[model samples]
Target: MYVLEGDKSAASRELLSRFTAPYYLLHGTDGKLGTGIRLLDCGDMMITMDVPTDFEKSLLRGKPAAVHP
Candidate 1:
């Protein structure tokens, strides 16, 4: 799995389009509770959820690794 900041680039999209295996993209967004989790896509399969604020906190317990553009 790859954790990247910002939106997916055109090149990245193009590369994923050529893959036969499934791919999952998760994006963070602002919501009433706090940070919102968005399941961008899952190749042929599709799934989504609005992660609870508490759950988000648990998911990010450790110091985040800096993501360079």
Candidate 2:
């Protein structure tokens, strides 16, 4: 998970810390919102806590395979 906040909330920081997967805090010359949007636009997939359990399940399933010629 890549967070786009200049400052994270205490609860969000705690939650992210508990995750074994790598989480990044993005800051760029483009600014936080622009950076986040760019990441989302370029990213293969994105998951949010709207359904925490389901998101966890998807994460546990791991990254998808890439096909090559």
Candidate 3:
């Protein structure tokens, strides 16, 4: 499985953009936790694991993700 580990400060949009592909961005919607993040799609399919947060349930927000597109 592809894992993105390291300090958030070290992670940048440019670096993440490199993963974009001509087709679908597979292995995306897998699993994640911690602070939320954003996702940019090139009409690709993203896979994410179910991680409904308690905060979201009470706050009426969406499921939290390491990234969100």
Candidate 4:
């Protein structure tokens, strides 16, 4: 797992503020390693969380697959 060095909490707050949509900060995930915090873009809005690798994979799995000819 890649760890981003520096003040992640402040950086995360700044990132979240850029979006116009409402969001809930999952503070529990702050400062946790391996479970990197992320800003999820949901087209109309967004979400922020710090989930384990398996949960992260599950989130990706929920997305629709692209088709290639």
Q: In terms of lDDT, which candidate is strongest?
A: 2
> Comparing 1 and 3 by lDDT, which wins?
3
List the RMSD of every prediction in angstroms: 11.1, 10.9, 12.4, 13.1
- The lDDT per prediction is 0.34, 0.38, 0.35, 0.34
Report the lDDT tens digits of candidate 2 across residue range 1-52: 4443333334434545664535643222221455545555788325322112
Candidate 4 residue 9 Cα shift, in angstroms, is: 0.6
Which residue pairs collide, candidate 2? none
Q: Top TM-score: which candidate number?
A: 2
* Model 3 lDDT tens row, 1-69: 132323222223333446566643535333344322333233232432232323234333554334323
Q: How do the residues 22-67 of candidate 4 rate in per-residue lDDT, one tens digit apiece?
A: 3343323344433343322223223333323333333357953221
* lDDT tens readout by residue for model 1, 1-69: 222223344433443344334555543323332122222343432433332324323435764323221
The residue ranges of model 4 lying beyond 4 angstroms of the native Cα positions read: 1-8, 21-69
Instruction: In model 1, state the lDDT of residue 61.
Output: 73
**TM-score for each predicted model, relative to the true structure:** 0.22, 0.37, 0.24, 0.22
Tell me the lDDT of candidate 1: 0.34
Global fold similarity of model 2 (TM-score): 0.37
